[model samples]
Each structure stands twice: as structure tokens, then as C-alpha cells.
Target: MGVSGCGKSTVGEELAKQLGVPFAEGDKLHPASNVKKMAAGTPLNDDDRWPWLDLVGADLRKGYEADGIVISCSALKKIYRERLRESCGGPLAFVYLEGSVDLLTERMGARTGHFMPLSLLQNQLATMEVPTGEPGVVTVNIDASPEEIVANALKGLASL
Candidate 1:
């Protein structure tokens, strides 16, 4: 999981394919009001996020019996990550896609037919608390090809 334009959806999809697991894009679960706010270029506050985050957490918990599942989400803070672990009640690995603001802006700008605007990206970056010290997290710098990032993530998972 990572911020907008960090390629969470893209990488998660590919990673799920590699692991042969189901993939859920957390953005799809956002309430329409949140989507409208984002579509209108307003960044959502924490108050607006809790319910949706909990929903994503619940979904993660639902697949506990499976080999694994991969999902794309903007888990930007330690609190958010904790909520995820609290739901899953076990160690889970996360591949954080990291990149520069310039890169992310460019990438977000290139995309089309999405509600998240480039304007909201900076707020996400500002809100992001990189999970360097978090348990069960593998941060993958996203500047490389998706293949390379996915390979590194798979290798990291092996060690855990």
C-alpha cells in the first residue's frame, strides 16, 4: 500500500497475479461522498476516512484462510497500518511504493478516468508516514520497473 500515484493499484494487481491471490482495490470501496470530494479536488480528513479504512481492514481479514490476498490501499499513517493488523490479527506484508513528488505528479497527471486528482497527491504525501519501523512491512522504492519491485517484494516475503 502507498499514496496516490505511487502505483499501488498497478503493483498490487501484478503482485496478486504472481502470488495467485485475489486483489481488492480499496479505492473502490470509498463512499460516493468521499469520491465526490476527491473528484472536486478536496483532500479528505481523517474523520472522513475512518469508516472506509475499517471496511478495507475487514476485507483483509476475510481472506485469512487463503494462501494470501493482495490489495491496493492508501495506508498513510501508523494508525492506519495498525488498524489493518488489528483486523487481520497476524503479521501481513506490505510493499510500499515510494517515489518523488515530481514523479508522482507526472504519473498522476498521465492517468485518466480516475477520481483522484494530482492536486490531492501532495496532501497524501504530506499525510504519509513511511513504515520504516513498522512490523510486517517491506518498503519497495517504486522508481524501478514493476517487475523489479515485485521481485524484491517476493524475496522479502520469503525472509519473513
Candidate 2:
């Protein structure tokens, strides 16, 4: 749970595979209007994110009986994470794929076929609250390979 280019989706998919759990891409749950706005290079506001966050949270909650599940979401604000927690009606383990603005911009620019633009990186970082002291949150620095990051996250989750 970091900015636009923080490798949330990539790491999430691998982590889910490692854990043998279902993986959900939170971006795909966004409303059409939100996608359109992002596709047009506009950063989304809180009003536009709450509904999408709720959907993602519900999806996460739906698999509570399973062994586990992994999902990629840019839960930028503390309130956003709280809202997700409320919707899930249970605990959640969040893995934050954090990186610097330069790295994020490079990653965003290298990627393609995505609605989130590099122009939105600064806005996302500005909105991010860093999740410090949040229960069940593991912050992983994005300075290594995806495999290494996933390994680190799995180890962190073990401690949680």
C-alpha cells in the first residue's frame, strides 16, 4: 500500500502465489468514471476513492475463511485504511511497497497500458500517510528485486 508505481500489484501477485491464496488487483475495482479521470491524467480525490476502497475491502473480507489472500491497493491515507478495516469487519495485514519519488517515476514511466500516469505520482505521495503504528502493517522498502521484496514481506508477515 504505497504510491502509484510502488510495485504493489507485482509484489501482490507473487506473494499470493507464494502463499497459495487468491490475488485481487484493486485498481480493477475502480469505477468507470474514476478510470476515465485517471486515464485523462487527473489525480483522484478522496470522494472518488472511498467507494472503490470499500469494494476492495469487501473482496478481501469475502475470503476470510480461506487460508489467506493478497491484494494490491494504494491505501494512501490513514482514514482510507481505517475505512477498509471497517468494511472488512476483521483484521488485515498490509504490505507497503515504499520507494522514492525518482524510483516511482521511473517505474511509472517504464510501465504501459495502465490508467495511472507518472503525473499522479507526486499527488499520491503527498496523500500517503505512511501507516506508522498501524496494526498488522509491514513496510518493505522497494530497493531490491521483487523476489527479495516478497521474501521480506513473507518473513515480516510471519512476525505479525
Candidate 3:
């Protein structure tokens, strides 16, 4: 998990396909109010995020009980990750998609139809607590092509 435009959905979907597991877009689980807030270019506070994180974690747990699942979540803070872990009540692996601000902004600018605006990218980056040294997390650089990024993620996850 990483900031917006870090390609979490793209990578997570490919990773799930490769692993023969279900894939869920965490953004889709967001409450309408949360979406409305973000769509209005307002950054969400922790209060707005906890319930959404719980929903994401619950979905992860459901897929875990079946055949494992890959989900794309911002998971921007250590506390947020912990919450997800608690809710999942099982193993959770995060593929942190790392990229430069310019790269991220460029990608965000190029995308459309997403509720998250490019204006919020800075806020997300500022709020993020990078998952470095965190257990069950793999840091994958996003400067490379999606195929390469996914390949590197697979390699890192294998070692995890």
C-alpha cells in the first residue's frame, strides 16, 4: 500500500491473478461520506478512516478464508496497518508501491473518474507513515513498468 497514483489497484489485481486469488479494490469499500469528503478535496481524518479500514480488513478476512485475496488500500499509517491486521485476524501482506512525487503526480494527473483528486496527493504523502521495517510488507519501487513492479513484488513476497 502507498499514496494515490502509486498503482496499488493495478499491481494488486495482477498479483492476485498470478496467485489465483480474489482481488478487491479497497476504495470501493469506502463509505459514501468518505468518498464525498475526498471528492471535495478534503483529506480524511483518522475518525473517517477507521470504519473504512475495518470494512477493508473484513473483506480481506473473507477472501483469506477462501483462497487468499489481494486488496489495494492507502494504509498510510502504522496504526492504520495495525487496525487492518487486527480486523483481518490472519496473515496480511502489504506491497508498498514506492514512487517519486513527480511520478505520482504525473500518474494522478493522467487518470480520470477517480474520486481522489490530484490535489490530495500531497496530503496523502504527508500523512503517510512508510511501512519500512514493518513485518509482512514488501516495498516495491514504482519507477519501473507494471510488469517489472509486479515481478519484483512477487520476488519480495516470496522471501517474506
Give the lDDT of residue 103 in candidate 2: 86
What does the lDDT read for residue 140 in candidate 1?
A: 80
* After superposition, candidate 3 runs with Cα above 4 Å error: none
lDDT (tens digit, per residue) of candidate 3 on 1-160: 9999999999999999999998999999999999999999999999999999999999988988887999999999999999998878688899999999999999999999999999999999999999999999999999999999999999999998
Error in Å for residue 62 of model 1? 0.7
lDDT of 1 at 138: 83
- Residue 8 CA error for candidate 2 (Å)? 0.7
The whole-model C-alpha lDDT of candidate 2 against the native structure comes to: 0.89
lDDT of 2 by residue, 33-81 (tens): 9999998889899899988998998888886656567889999999998
CA error at residue 78 for candidate 1, angstroms: 0.5
Candidate 1 per-residue lDDT over residues 45-98, each given as its tens digit? 998899998888888887555657887889898898888888875667878788
Where model 2 places Cα greater than 4 Å from the true spot, the runs are none
Q: What TM-score, computed on C-alpha atoms, does each candidate reach?
A: 0.95, 0.96, 0.98
Query: What's the best-to-worst order under lDDT?
Result: 3, 2, 1
The lDDT for every candidate, in the order shown, is 0.86, 0.89, 0.95
